[model samples]
Target: MNKPVPPPRLRMALIGCGQIADAHLQEAAKVDSVEVVAVCDMHMDLAKQAAARFRVPGIYDNLDRMLAEAKPDVVHITTPAHTHGPLTMKALAAGCHVYVEKPFTLDAIEAETVIAAAESAEKKLCIGHDQLFDPTWLDCRSRIAAGQIGHVRHIESTLGYPISGQFGAVVAGDPRHWVRQLPGGLFQNTISHPLYRILDLLPDLHPRVEARWDRTKYDFPTELWVQLRGAEITGSLTFSSSVYAQRVTRVYGDQGMLEVDFDAQTIRRHTAPKLPGAFGRLEMPFRQWREGARNLQRNLWRFLKCEIHYFSGMRNLMAEFYRSIQQDTEQPITNAEMLRVTRIMDEIFADCRSREERVEEFVPETRELEVVR
Candidate 1:
């Protein structure tokens, strides 16, 4: 009997050779079903550097030329948030499947427009919600599905961003940075990571939003609190630049609770104590210690197997997306979920702006009284 031949790999071209671009390329390289043929950036130097580093054959300063000459089957847009809408539409129009990085677009309207274009083009579209596919998160989802945590009632997702860090410093230093142009500014660029996790659990897209935006650590608003109320599930989000960097999501359920730490790639499950009364209360600390040890062992095992890394989620998401296109199946992320996340962000930002205006109005009157005194 003759062995079967494998299908050809999908040709990929990456646009926007910025800080995030390298991540996309690095992860995609691990997916055997895809090959990056070209890289493009407005700055010729950036494009050249990326091509040389990745050993890609085609390099172009213009997107139109790259799309025409490279003739790639897929396009990865790792550009700034503002250009996502237009660039995605262009790629879809060129008849290429798109894997665009999040904040899918500036707002829900732009998201809808780009999604509609992808539909019209009949190409698969995916957002860079890689954390949703991380190994630890996958394990959490499995336990939830197995009813370990029954009937999820609430979720709290918090993200810590250090303004003095590499990317944050760039945005904080330049007032004219593209990120500053976004509606929600830094929050718009990042909160999508935590926001989508909540949307995945919500029963419906329409959620009542309440938010507070305050600037405590920087001139720009660096602290945000958003509460989302769904039909049965409620969620709260915290994004702080002043705190120590961390990414954690706590899920509350009727039967038990689960806390997932993205940075440590660990999860802890809490349930009713085994013993009765005071003994049970005392036993809780032991259970916590055991869980921590288990997490450490799991991480160590993964490390030994060469399965642990920060971009593991991105690698898995890329492979799934490639397989979906090759097998002609549904993409891992639904357009509805993407739109829902964007719409929630829109509401939160709008509410924050209204609150800021009210504060501005009150502040001037106080200043006038001080001048008279």
Candidate 2:
């Protein structure tokens, strides 16, 4: 066979012009080989707004119309969770590589269907779980691989959002918010961020899980906790809209505990507790002060060097997706991994429903048993 030549640049089209689409567009702007040929939304106002802001050449209120006209090499799906499956399938059938936002689909069956379509179309599919592309997470994973933290036993990922914060307040004001209608409620929109990172370190085929979803202050169940049990390792995801805003993950290994702050882009390790209480207490403030200074220096340096960008991980992921399409390489996030995350979510939602009044609403448990293709 003759060697394939990579295209000069990939024409890109984006669907859904909501808050997240701006992040996608900003990131795409940072990448060199992807061109924003068009923008699509059910609302013409949204489409026109995005086009005006992003300098996109084409604007359409319908996806099929844009796909047919733009003939984009890549379709960035930024639609709601429920629409991901159909849109992804449509793009894949159009022979366009797909970059979809997280919560790949409402359920695992839909995820499998999208995966199969991509395979049949001979195109690449990338999910929007950009946290794995984060420099802090990668550094932490590398340390774990080097056994800097010893044998991994458990991980706890905590994501806190102030419900009254800018976006949350808006969602709270509307009773008909898209997030409130999700099968997993608030979790459906946010849980995937941490679960994908957790699943990366703890990949269990038949993992056991325990979960809880409840509302203490918020009108809806804004708090969620899901624990996954593997034979060798266990992981937990705690997402709360009421807590003070923070994103951090803790890795409990035999040698020590590794703490990673995603927003701060800092990783701190705690070795086996050897220091005496009084001395450790005396040294703690200095240690924290030094660490803070170091983090500030690192972040400032990265920003000065143009190494830092908002939603940088998302940008890195989009760039990698384009590279995979051009070079015929493996996807940045594999379909199997995407399916597993959806399956895990399925189990949690099912379990939560069975406990609450929402039982019988979740898809059957059989979907969680999907095999890797």
Candidate 3:
């Protein structure tokens, strides 16, 4: 007997029709299991344009109206930082799973509120710290677990880029707006990725941060230094927006080191010496390794076919949200982790406000990393 096939698509609603929203639309279109049924934006014109481009039937200037009309199973919020929590709460209350843009909310309190709302509603709430969804991150986790570099002792990650402020200005479309008012800032946007990544990789670590910013000396501080603690490792992250685009992460251990360029899709490892050398030095030979660019290019091509790898990590996250909701299971990236990241952000901001000149040492309570089943 022939069996009936389940429907391939799940209905989706987009709550913001901005630049990031377009990336969502493009990616959602490629996933055979999802359909964008409607779009809403504060700007009606932008919503209309997005709907037309995505071929969604419904468009609205109001989120409530859109939700009432579309009744989508998934609601994606790509709104500005401040509006994320409110919109997510509203969506969850309406019995819809949510995928929110980065930073989740402006502060930890807002994140807690939304998380509680999602729990009460029994709907899934996922943040868009997409870097965790990257395959490179997955591979990194696997290697770390296998002790490929022994015990991870320190980590250094950085992201920087040349800026005209044109992209942000266009998105905000208001010269005096806060998003536009701050040019080349890491706190508001860029640091979210590295912070989230660290939390994801080192789940047991609670980071305490001390940061300094000088607006007169540099555009938007342009640099952030963070020290993190874990049961088995202690790490530091330096993020800067002033230099040309450079993204790299180095994981060091007692035995050796592993370096990854996420953007470049490359990984290199240095092994410990198996034998002693003349000067009592272990003489661990340095070896260069690369994940052929062609392989990375091919994976990227496959990823782009569905707009998967775009926007840092949203596509993979949306898939996980769907699975979590359907299976009624806890997601790998949880509200607890998000809250921890928020706390770290808060510490950084508070430290910046104090104008502290030196890094403050913090001893974190160590909890061992449980092996993933």
Give the top-scoring candidate (lDDT): 1
Off by over 4 Å in 1: 368-373
Off by over 4 Å in 3: 1-4, 165-175, 180-186, 216-219, 272-286, 289-312, 356-373
List the pairs of residues colliding in candidate 1: none
Candidate 2 global CA lDDT score: 0.87
In order, candidate lDDTs are 0.92, 0.87, 0.71
Among these predictions, the greatest TM-score belongs to 1
The TM-score measured for candidate 2 stands at 0.90
Per-residue lDDT tens digits of candidate 1, residues 104-151? 999999999999999888999999999999999899888889899899
Candidate 3: give the clashing pairs. Answer: 130-313
Q: Relative to the unseen true structure, what is the C-alpha lDDT of residue 158 in candidate 2, on a scale of 0 to 100?
A: 94
Using TM-score as the measure, name the better of candidate 2 and candidate 3. Answer: 2
* Model 1 vs. true fold: TM: 0.97
Q: Give the TM-score of each candidate.
A: 0.97, 0.90, 0.82
Q: How many clashes show up per model?
A: 0, 0, 1
- Give me the displacement of residue 164 in model 3, in angstroms: 2.6
Per-residue lDDT tens digits for candidate 3, residues 26-129, read 87776667888999998999999999888999899988898888999999999877778888989988889888888787788888898888888877777777
When sorted by lDDT, best at the front, the candidate numbers are 1, 2, 3
How many backbone clashes are present in model 3?
Answer: 1
Scored against the true structure, residue 152 in model 2 reaches a CA lDDT of 92
